[model samples]
Target: MTSITIRNVPDEVHRALRIRAAMHGRSTEAEIRGILEQAAKPEGRLKLGTLLNSIARDAGGLSDAEARRFDKLRDRAPAEPMRFE
Candidate 1:
């Protein structure tokens, strides 16, 4: 394993990291390691259905009627093409 030294991190950011580490019951160094690990890994792509489901869940789950109305709005015809002289 390699070691690194991060130089000149802002005081507020360092403080926040310490607070987060305390919250998660980890040392600040361990918290930094976890942060670096997550940053190094590529995040998985969220599919449209998955993204929509998450949004619906956060918004208290959309009603069936609301979903239908959204679908109708989404399927509406595009606006008329611009006619430039």
Candidate 2:
């Protein structure tokens, strides 16, 4: 196996990695290796169903007219106004 070195990592990012490793009950090196292995796999793209589901969720099941109405309302709504008394 080959060795690699990652240098000049930010303290906050390192701290985050430590926290994640602890959460997963893994050593920092093991946690990083697992993540890298998953990421390095060729079949790494988001699954089509997952992508479509996310899109459908964001779209809120609106019909064409409903979406158009929502866009119009969003565009015309006041950005800021007085709160209700």
Candidate 3:
């Protein structure tokens, strides 16, 4: 877990934060956490999985039947555990 300390916040800003926190039914700290979380890692950000899917779509997208056939062709059995004496 990581901890951050914000310094010298203006009084009016702090009061507004408190009010917003109350409106959201959360503690001021929780409100700040949610705000910071959203600011830092936004919902609309391009995720790796999403980017890969987009790329796949651009490059003649993988079809369900192709995916099913791929799965059928794979080695499904669990791998043998390594013996390191």
Top candidate on TM-score is 3
Cα lDDT of model 3 by residue, 1-85, tens digit = 6999999999999999999999999999999999999999999899665577567756877775765565578676767989999
Worst 10 residues of 2 by lDDT: 69-78
CA lDDT for candidate 3: 0.84
Residue 65 alpha-carbon offset, candidate 1, angstroms: 41
Ranking by TM-score: 3, 1, 2
TM-score of each: 0.50, 0.48, 0.70
Residue 42 in model 3: shift from native, Å? 0.9
What ranges in model 2 sit over 4 Å off? 42-85
Tell me the RMSD of model 3 versus the true structure: 7.6
Candidate 1 residue lDDT tens string, 1-85: 8999989999999999999999999999999999988887647856565579568957888876777677676735556989998
- Return the TM-score for candidate 3, rounded to 2 decimals: 0.70
Clashing pairs in 2: none
Worst 10-residue lDDT window for candidate 1 reads 41-50
Q: Write the per-residue lDDT of candidate 2 for residues 52-78, one digit (tens) a residue.
A: 645765888756676556556654444
